[model samples]
Target chain A: MSDIVQSLEGLLERLHIDVGLRPILSLVILLAAVFAVICAALWGAVRARWISRNTAAFWIFVSPWIVGFLLFTGGPMVYSLVLSFTNWNLIDPAKFIGIANYKEALSDPDLGQAIKVTLTYAVVSVPLQTVLSLAVALLMNVKVRGIHVFRTIWYLPSLVTGVAQAVLFIWVFNPSYGLANGLLRLFGIEGPKWLFDAHWALATVVIMSLWTVGGNMIIYLAGLQDISKDLYEAAELDGANRWRLLWNITIPQVSPVIFFNVVTGLIYAMQTFTQGYVVTHNGGGPADSLLFYVLYLYQNAFSFFRMGYASALAWIFFVMIMVLTALVFRGSAFWVYYESQRPRERRRRVHVG
Target chain B: MSASAKAPTVKAPTVKAPTAKGAGGPRREPLGGRILAVTLLVVGSIGFVYPFLWMIATALRTPEGVSHGGVSLWPIQWRWSNFTDGLGSFPFWAYLRNSLLSTIVPVVAVVFSSSLVGFAFARIRARGSGVLFAIVLSTLLLPQEVTIVPQFILFKNLDMIDTLWPIIVPTFFGSAFFIFLYRQFYLRLPEAMTDAALIDGAGWFRIWFSIYLPLSRPIIIATAVLQFMSYWNNFFQAAIYLTTDRWKTLPLALAGFQSVNGTNTPLLMATALVVTFPCVLLFFIAQRHIIGGISFTGSK
Candidate 1:
């Protein structure tokens, strides 16, 4: 290996390539070499009639994803699991520690705080965001004039990038002269220090989460647009009031969409990092109230150089997410209604008769 | 019993009827209810739009004007030089160039590779394809945080840290979500379109490039728009990889600026606006495709 590398380096030097560009050039060359070998093998297989033309074409097309999956995602995932059992700080050599990191995690108060904060944020924000976005979607679903303009305005805030949103909201929630307190002052009420007060810090983040409810609102609008008009008309003919129509027909009709949004929203909310990181200037805001799970994991890995411990934390988080996702999916069968399932139901009824 | 036999046929029109009308359901709402909804929406829009107006106003204000200003939309004095000052505060142009390079390269790379893979997944039949596609879908649920550490280590070993390569190179492999989008789109295209080309002895690659790709303008645009927003707004990987100012992107620079100049409210807002304007412009120009792309994931 060393001899080949030395020869390659000599060849590159003879070519007079710049030092900074040498590594990238070598990588390209390596990838091309691998591609050549794979192509040759594939050609051999096709000539031998071991595989069909369509199979060869399929492999060629999907090679990028297969290569990328192994290099970027699959390999790293397995490496992360291995790292969880060892002590490596990015500088020194790694030493096998045999689950010491996980053992320590059991007694770690910081991890506990991080978990508590993350769960609270996800639990509080997910439901609130769901309800608020649903309400806005319902309002936007009506055939009012110029509803598009209102929709554009509502979604404009969601377009702001996370860092910019955090910076803008820092001013908006400024204790004395910011917009939140400024608006409150107009109503003869003094607002508490948001993003600064420990008691209100997480709550303030929850409020900030609602600003992007337009994202989910659009999805809900799509779901509402999908509901059959016949269901509403039938309900009305049966003396169903507006509330009854909404509760019975509309909700059930869109239940699958609701399930999707809630599952995705909860998963997203659990991984909160950017807002807290930006608002608190890379610290846990106000007595660790903003010590989100991912943020804590980040600090452990990058700030404190505890890569192994961070890997353990990441694994724990993975399991938590898996469990939560499974529970939601398992619960979905009870509540989510699929229009396609009606055929099966009808068949079953026919058999019963 | 007969109705039960016809249930599958009955389902098709009902599913598509509301969508054909361009709006769902009858507007049986009374005038009073309509007026109330319109009023509430207008009021709520002000709340949603007020912060942005305030941001622009504050960005245009003098430092003292911002400190003394109440909750007002109008600036006391328009300080146009704040933008220039903010631009000059750091290596703004260099960072902007870096940001464009990182974002644009990834956008083009992801679109090309994803569409290629998606076409194969949707159109071609091969053994083990089903399992491979399932693995691709499963990766969507894997939080990026789990892989960040080892990815950093991988880049570090490759001597690609502190450069844009770490951010740009991986995108060439294609992203899962974009591949899924392309797959969903290609699956809907009639197979006969490709069959004709194949019967004429055209290769699968040629058929995909000549026939399928031209028909895929909508998906391409939608993927590009969505990918552009994500790569441009990306912060986490940029923060980890680009540790040096030599190749820092705009968001990373902005974060550094905030830590140093946390108290410079006016200049900060001006800088933040500079970083934010492109995304807002893109959203307005391609919002139909953006919303369609998002809802496509939901409905499917």
Candidate 2:
């Protein structure tokens, strides 16, 4: 067995696979071993009539994902956590440093600025987008002629995002000649340098983010259509005005949709990268004001070769998402009204394809 | 959507004809409110439409026309040469072929793998499938930032960097979000359909291949189109993985074009338009399927 193992290792080395890859390759081997064990156990169980045929089928069907989860997602997460504590440049053998990366991250001024910028972005974009999307949805739900045409046109901005969005907006946000400033000139208000101005760079990026709110608007339309029409009538009979009905009925009816948008918006805002990276030409922004947390993390990992430090930043981001998501979920009880769960909700939940 | 739209009106008998101005059953918006709403919608639509118009205009304009950017909606001179010269700058055909290979292979894999995993969770019975499904959903919250570095390291070690393998390989593994999407559709399918297949001495694969797939036309198209858009527009993965100019994707290729041809705004827009127009055209053609899939996954 030792001789066979030695020969196999020699064969692999001759194949030009790197030493750094040996760990992941071993992880893959371990995964296959575990899969083999599970298969043997399943076979034994089936022969002994310990588990049902249906249960076996489920496992067989689910096998690919289980293997994938372990090999790709769960394994990488665990590996990165380990990487966070070690000084590993991609080229070198990693040194085991003890919490040095995390300690340095706490004092890193760039990380501080990145965090501040990220939070400002999340705070500004989330609520505004949620409201804007909801308002648009409300209007969309109006039973007017040619509404779907308007809907299609509104959703156009959402079609192209990421790098293309940033590229198009480059001309749009140009100081002397771009459309944004030119439009502002129509009102005789001088526009800032927009993408070039440090004071305005973050705001310009925020506006770019909002350009695609029409995507959320589509969801809001669906939610609005889901609202019970009887509630509106009943509210009207009680002499409630349109404003009151909007405040009381329309909102509560679509609170679940609102909840979904807010959560996703928060998450997306926190990870704002492509626009900042593209617009800034991958070098943060004017005075690094547009340096988002993920951009900073990407720079550390790939650009600067500070892999361990980037991993530490990643962990910090993970924790923030966990805490923030949990908070939103916990607070959702007060605001979000799921019609299915409501005691007085009149209709049964029907599954729509 | 059709059911939701029709249901409230038929069931409740409250929503009146929208054209019934100031009707008693449903108070139509007053004249002032209607005008205000219409104005908002029109203004909002312009906000969305103008950028694309500008993009097209910029793409068609001469270099001098672009630099002399006045408030003109029409190009001073329609220069088709912008595209020829701009796309001619790099190995556009090579980059496009690279982009297509990356996109097509991954999209097909994602659809296949995700649907299989989703079917197991939806139709097959197991002891711990629920727990596994919950774990899958929770993992959706796991940021790519956390896994990106280690994944790169793993790929690097395997000598896969600068190749298309890194971008394409992960999609063969199931994406959690797409899994959840397919699972939702499969779960809502009647249990009797699978049971009938079982009674006919058929198996899980047969039922999935025949009944479930045939009935799932909308979702399959939606998933495919969405996946196509994602792969087509993706920049970060290409930036991280593909080092060579020859292997760059459309988005990365456009970025390179922008950097090198920075002075020629029209040429830059032309390249950007070349990258963007196909997707925008796709959105127009498959708007229904795209919206159906997105709004389906987006809400509950």
Candidate 3:
């Protein structure tokens, strides 16, 4: 038993010293096994006589996605989990290294800070965005002319992304010549160095994120549109004040949308990568305040070729999402008001039925 | 339900409209208050819009004055030559072509595949599709970062490392988001529309193509425009896949320009504007569909 174990260890070390080819060969073998399993499933599905059973159309429609799922999503996820257990750069043969990657990840100082920065971004951005978007939507929901034009204009910033957005924002936040400072000059308020100062840098990103509130504004506007003016008139007739109507009617009416935005916004915030990356030229902000989670992960996987460690990081990220989503869904019963419980919703359902 | 709330609050464009709701049992707001409200809104609109206009104006200015231009809304010295100079920074036309090619192929593929699966999930009553649809919905939260390493390796194995195939092939499969959008649309479609076609002995393809496809022009266009904009603006995907200058998309090229001319503000703005204008123009032209698509929900 000892001799066998020694030989195995020696063989692994020898394989580890080999360049590129063995890892690629191992991946190809795995790919072949996956392909064989996929072929068996397809064969079994075909043998079920879906055509005669009248479900062939469904399979045909969904076939592309099933193949894609096997290749891209499910297969990769499983492979990544396996990769997490092995220490291999693309250039080296992989060797089993149990729990080492996750252990390293937990202790990695840069990763800990990155996680904090990401959380700070999410904690700051999500609630502020929810409130601000609803506020803007209420403002725009007025029965005024040309509101559509304003709505489109407000949405423009949200649509402006990628290199254009990054470059434009860098200019907008430039201390000496940026519009933020130039406008501040008009008000006799000097703007702080944004994106340059660590204290203000994450705030700069949050502010940049606010520009996209027009997206949530549109969703809220849709919800608000469903609230008939008659409800407001009735509330007023009942001696309900403006604030009372806003608090009681408008807030409840828009709560579902607000919930949707919160969930998506939280997810988007956790995965914040591109703008921060581009703004800092991928080095991260001053004092590394903008060193977000995914940025670090990307650097690990690609720049450093620490694929095993990055896979571990990816697994942790997936778990975080799963936990957060589960928690939100569990907690949503208290906050997310479903209209279906109301008589009006029942009437609408009846009409549809 | 009411013909229209004839209250002055809605009819009158005034600042004091806020108070019109329960203002001493019924009274219109003062005209000055209305003017103040409109003035505030108008000023806020300027703040929202002027930067884009400023971007366009700055793009036309000579490189020297933009630094000290003090956020001028108009070009001090119109140097249309900046556009030409900006184009000279890299292989601009090639990058534009690459962007168009990458986006166009994916747009076509996404539209075809999304609607196909959408039709299956929404229309065909088949076993296991519910589970499939649920999987699609849940995976919507799966971040791309988790798969980047394996995806890179997979493509590397396929010898597609530097090619456009790595970027565009996935779209040939359906995207979950668009599939969901199409499924929602199909599910909400009037049953009579499909039932009547079925009575005429239409096959699945006939129902989807002859009846549904023609009627789904708005959605198809909306999906196309959105997909094109995303593909055109995609930085992360391109950064991972394309290494050679020959195949770099416009966004990557724009980033390259930013790196090369880090201080040339006007040239950078010009290049940025040129790269982004197509998406803006698409949005402007199709504003209705884009907005309507977002606002659309299944309802009575």
Candidate 4:
């Protein structure tokens, strides 16, 4: 029996394949061992003697997030970072490629175009959406009869998913069989083939996108609500017209919300994927007019199987957003208003104190 | 253009407004102003609602009735068969069942998991919690495409490809963005209720369930509704992971119908409508939840 056991061990070692139950068990044990180490570290910082009282509560709260971070963020993030240094397809062993992928991505014309289009989309859409949302919110704030119903109706489009909403727009923008054309025909003017015409496609998409301004509108409404009614009443008594009131009281009060929406909206618009994808058959539509930054990254990563290059593109985008956000933050001091901010002369005394 | 710089000028006008209203007892007509306001609202509402109405109209049209020009308020012929034909065209029922499974399970998982994580960040000041939160938030910036390859590789290795596991599993971990939203909401809640629960010998789980869950209904409903729609509208993940026709969700099914066959316009429109119908129905049903959801995250 001893001889047989020795021979079996030798055979398994020679084959390099773990045929015995012990090897498999050991592998499982190794995995558990790693898990235990992580759990122990977390507990030590979270609930152990050295930790603070809220450790367990914090750990317990974060427990659900751990799995997501590990799987979605930690694992994939590290994997992709490593991947950005390699040449790997879906199945192939990743070949070590120095900075070739990074170089290629920088030089890619499609990527350049994508960046331009994405910036244009973000630049145009974010401001437009913000203005429209504020305008609509202002309109809804009035004491019109059945205004609540109108508010609900206006907000309807924003609640619908991007896929459905874009599909609805696509139908309306369909060159041959769309309502847009029909409406144009009513005026004896031919509608430009909106989707298929490269010149008009991106613009049309931007216009279609503006229809769902309701999401930001609701936030503006909340901000509007927070503004004291006394101010508006005061404005009315001072003979301030509607535009003057909107320009003065409303805009200043809601400027912070507008700033928030602008940053978020720009990020969202830059990464506009679903509309570009679904409308253009999983690619940017109509001669790449809708070739959004994230869409291009997606195409490179999944469609073209250029994982490393796509990673580079993603990092570039991340850098761009960071810079843009920082710029916005810096610039915000010039535009955004806080109700707590007193007059400029008063602000000096408060700051000094 | 510091907001404060512009404040004083507007402030003066508003202060004068009430006195003016008293002095001028309903002056002669500002008829032009009222007409302009009415016209703007009417035009805006029409623009907002028209596409949705057109979607309905197109879905109602027969093959012969599908004309680009001459779209009217009413369809020339109401082809109700389009709905029936759409339902009959493919495995529509199966798609719905699959969508329910895909959307509901993941939504429940995301809400439960993200909320739990959110509560930790909001309530507990554990070591590394801030760092961990920052790391998680960073993931929000890494567009989903960046990680799709590795995840696909991981799923392939796990033999979970072609299954709903890909869509369902990640959601169980909790989304960083949603968790952030929930955390902000949780932070704003009064601390007294939590302390009372602790005094009553309620365990963490018990407090979270019995007190926090009930109190956070608005955010919970909003998150759930949003997550439900997220799963429902998910395209690339479904498109990549689900190969078999039986496994297709509504978006994938609808996309397939558009691309695979030639110009069968009526059938295509019908299929698209069916795919979109649930979301629209959901929007109407949960309209109140929508506003609440936006408020929690939109301003922040």
Candidate 5:
């Protein structure tokens, strides 16, 4: 018996040539099996006529994405919701905790601070970005030669990746060996340590947010183009000069675009993460002035392993965005023009039924 | 309904009167008006262009040269090697390849999926399309934070960890904003084209591909450019899904460069410029299509 056990051990040792290759081979086999299953399922879907021929072609073209969304998005969304109700530390059996996660997230002080900072950023950045974009777009709309080049140049910064731009701004706002301070020196003004100072750290982020008006400006330029030349000509005859024209004609015509920008920008700014993540040394800088809501959520999920709490925070964010967007749309009837609205109203009155 | 009935009655008198009178008049730009316009244009242009130029200047300055500039319009030494040195300093080629691979698939996926779904919503009489579309649109309202945790957990269980699936798969779902834009555009297209195609026994996909996609080049280009830029700029997602240095995208690589070469302002600046150049080149190339897309979205 001892000799048989010794021989078996020796054979096992001989078979174990490389430790890494086993896992990799197993993984490949698993993936190949999954691919086969996916192929079979897709073939069934096609053969069943559940999807039309044309639709089949369309789906085929977008098959990679559909699989991705199902696995990555749909699958994750379901799992996350399930996770939010569980007390899984990623190792042990997940315990059902019900609403405890929600309560904890609400009570978390860091979460509150992050929410406050994000709201403040949204309030400041969204309006500033929208107004500035419109202002710049208006200026660019003037019938000046070579203005297209100017428009292109102005938009250059927006095209640059946010990571690179944020990095550049960090240097610009650096107290020492930065251009912002150097510019301040020219005017005999001492520059505050922009990223370091707690009082101004959030403000520094706000300023950075505003600097990327190029994206919004491009959108506003599109809005400007929608303003028919006939409308401007008509306004001119009434002696409505540029300011008056802009106030009455241009503003009203592009009000819908403004609304689009405002709502989307508000949502975007409220969820501001990248700039906040990069600038704040990964924890909101100094005293958490730059702690954005999404950043907080990220910290909870990744850094703290509070997955359940983070999920609760995410749902809260979703609810908030929905409410805010609904409010905007509800109020839009006062300003947003719909060509079909009047006719629909008229048709409603004519309905005998 | 009550508000709408009253609106036209109130504005109808004003709109009609203004429309005719406004059409015949040649706009007269007075000396004061001309000066005001020029001044505003110059100021706006300066505000827009100055920071970018400053960024470029900072990029070209040497470590010592940047310190000496002190708000000077131009760099002192113009350290050209900063660009080469910046490229050499990190796993830039790997990042670029990953970014390129990642960006291309998503762009193609989104364009195809969005158009198909958009056409269904726009022109077809599919049951529950409106409700389905509304659901799709609602996805835009959900912040990325809400989903990230779930997404991460999902990927982990699926053993998609350390893979690009987390970043690439979401693009297949089709963007709510882009789908909405395409839907609006499809609405504006002459309905006769679709009706004729239908009469000829052409399927919905045929009409979409043969008719819609062909005619919508301007918008398609515009959307592709925008998505391309968005994908290029994406950092947070890449930061989360990708951990290994080899798996990093361009934006991640750029951020690493900043963190490492941070003390040398000139080298950092040069790197920033080089990183940004490709996107700038893309924008210039697709400027017309982009402008067209912008106008279309705005007017709607």
Candidate 6:
């Protein structure tokens, strides 16, 4: 492999190509070569009538995703798994250390802190965001004048990017001179040093996460809008009050949407990095209270150059997300009311009654 | 009853029109309850909107006034120079150009590539396509972190690090999520349309390009707007790859600005606002498509 690469470099250098352009030139050449080979094979297969023209066309159309999947996703996934067992920093030749990185993860204090902080953030923030966004959705769902303007105002905050939000909130939560404290002072109360305070740092991060609940609120509103009016009217005719209507009709009708939000939200919260990274100024915040799992993994990868260990951490995080998502899916079986299952549900109720 | 019957066919009624009648027949809220709901919404809107107002106000304040922050949205002293001075102090235009290039190219690339692939998946019945489609959807769950380390290594080996290639190139291959979105959209497209084109002896590419693509204006706009927001706001991959100033994007540059000038609140807010304005503007301009794209993904 080195010999082939060396000769390719020799050929490029001999051609007097600019050094920066050589990589790009070679990549183009490699892609062209692959394209030609695939074309030839496809042509041969078509001529031989081994595959239909539609089948051949399908491959040609989808080739971009296939090539990308192999190169970027599938290849890297396998490589990352292999790297998790090695002792490679970026500078060193990879040495197969055989689970040393994973073993170290078991007792690594920073890793432990990261897991704890991340889980706490996810646990606290996901449900709060789900419920809060749903509540806001219900509020916005009310048929009132100028509701669009109000909805837009509520959603505008979610448009701020993560880094910008973190920076803005740092100023907002400034220990002595910030909005949170300024408001607290107005109420004749003292606010803790928010991002600067050790105990309050993680909670501040959670609060920051809630600032973007408008995105999910819109989703819930859409779900709420889709509920058949007959369901509500029938329940109302049976003397269901507003509270009971919300509980029995609205909640079950939107449970699928709730399931979707919770799953995606949990996945997203677990991978939280930009907030912690920006808030802590690329360091763990306030004695590592805001040391999110991805941030710690990032530190290991880029700052510390522990590529192998970072890959191990990445896999562990991946598994944790998968397990959590699976648990949610398992639990959703009981609470998630699918409209398609209504027939069976009615039959079951009939038997029970 | 008439309004509720029309609701299902309207396709994204601006608001829940049926809820008015469905809550109870021709009912008005009690005056007290109405007042309470109004107050709650107003207060909630204030909570959501005040930080942004504070940001703008602080950006206009002198550095000293910023440090003495109060809950006032009124600046004591207007420092219009904060925008000029902040722009001058940082390479804002250069970063903005890089941001636009990375974002625009990917939006165009992903839209084209994903739609093509999505068309094939939705219309074509090749033997392995079902499994391939499944694989595409499954990739959506594979976290980017799981792939980032090796991808970094791969890009490094390709000598593409510290450049925009790592950030922009993979997007040309097509994104799993966007592909899925396009697939869902195309699947709903009537099969008769494609069959008519096919019967006219049009090729697959021609059918996709002429018939389906023209008909797919809504999904196209939705995907484009959504992609624009994501790529514009993207920080992590850009942070990993574009280590040099030559291709530093707005979010990364703003984060750098914050670190270097941590104490300069007015300047920081000015720069942050400049970085954030495009997304905010896009949201207002294409609010329907953005909201539709998001809820479409959720409901489906």
State the TM-score for model 3: 0.86
lDDT tens readout by residue for model 3, A131-181: 888877766665455666778788887777867888888888889888889
lDDT (CA) for every model shown? 0.84, 0.80, 0.77, 0.72, 0.71, 0.85
Give the DockQ of candidate 4.
Answer: 0.26
Error (Å) of candidate 3 at residue B262 is 0.6
Ordered from best to worst lDDT, the candidate numbers read 6, 1, 2, 3, 4, 5
State residue A96's C-alpha deviation in candidate 6, in Å: 1.3
lDDT of 2: 0.80
Which residue pairs in candidate 6 collide? none
DockQ of 1: 0.50
Scored on chain A only, each candidate's TM-score is 0.94, 0.87, 0.82, 0.82, 0.80, 0.94
lDDT of 5 by residue, A98-136 (tens): 989888877888888887888888888788888888877
List ranges where model 3 is wrong by over 4 Å: A1-52, A343-353, B1-37, B297-300
Best by TM-score: 1
Per-residue alpha-carbon lDDT of candidate 6 for residues A182-234, written as tens digits (9 for 90 to 100):
99999999999999988999899888888889889888877887877788778
Tens-digit lDDT string for candidate 2 (A124-187): 9888888888888777665456777888888888877877788889888888878988888888
Candidate 6 deviant stretches above 4 angstroms: A1-19, A344-353, B1-32
The TM-score-based order of candidates, best leading, equals 1, 6, 2, 3, 4, 5
lDDT per residue (tens digit) for residues A1-353 in model 1: 33444466567878998877765676667667767877888789999999987888898889889888887898988989999999998889999999899999999998999999999999999999989998888888787767778878998888876788888888899998799999999999999999999999999999888988887888788888877788888878899998998888888888888998998898899988887788777898999999999999999988998889988998999999989899989999998999989999999999999
Give candidate 5 misplaced runs (Cα > 4 Å).
A1-75, A228-244, A339-353, B1-28
List native contact recovery per candidate, as a fraction of 1.
0.64, 0.49, 0.48, 0.42, 0.44, 0.61
TM-score of chain A of 4: 0.82
C-alpha lDDT of residue B259 in model 2: 65
Model 3 lDDT, residue A347, Cα = 89
**With candidate 1 superimposed using the best TM-score fit, by how many Å does residue B300's alpha carbon deviate from the native?**
1.6
lDDT (10s digit) by residue, model 5, range B124-161: 76444566667667666666766788777766654456
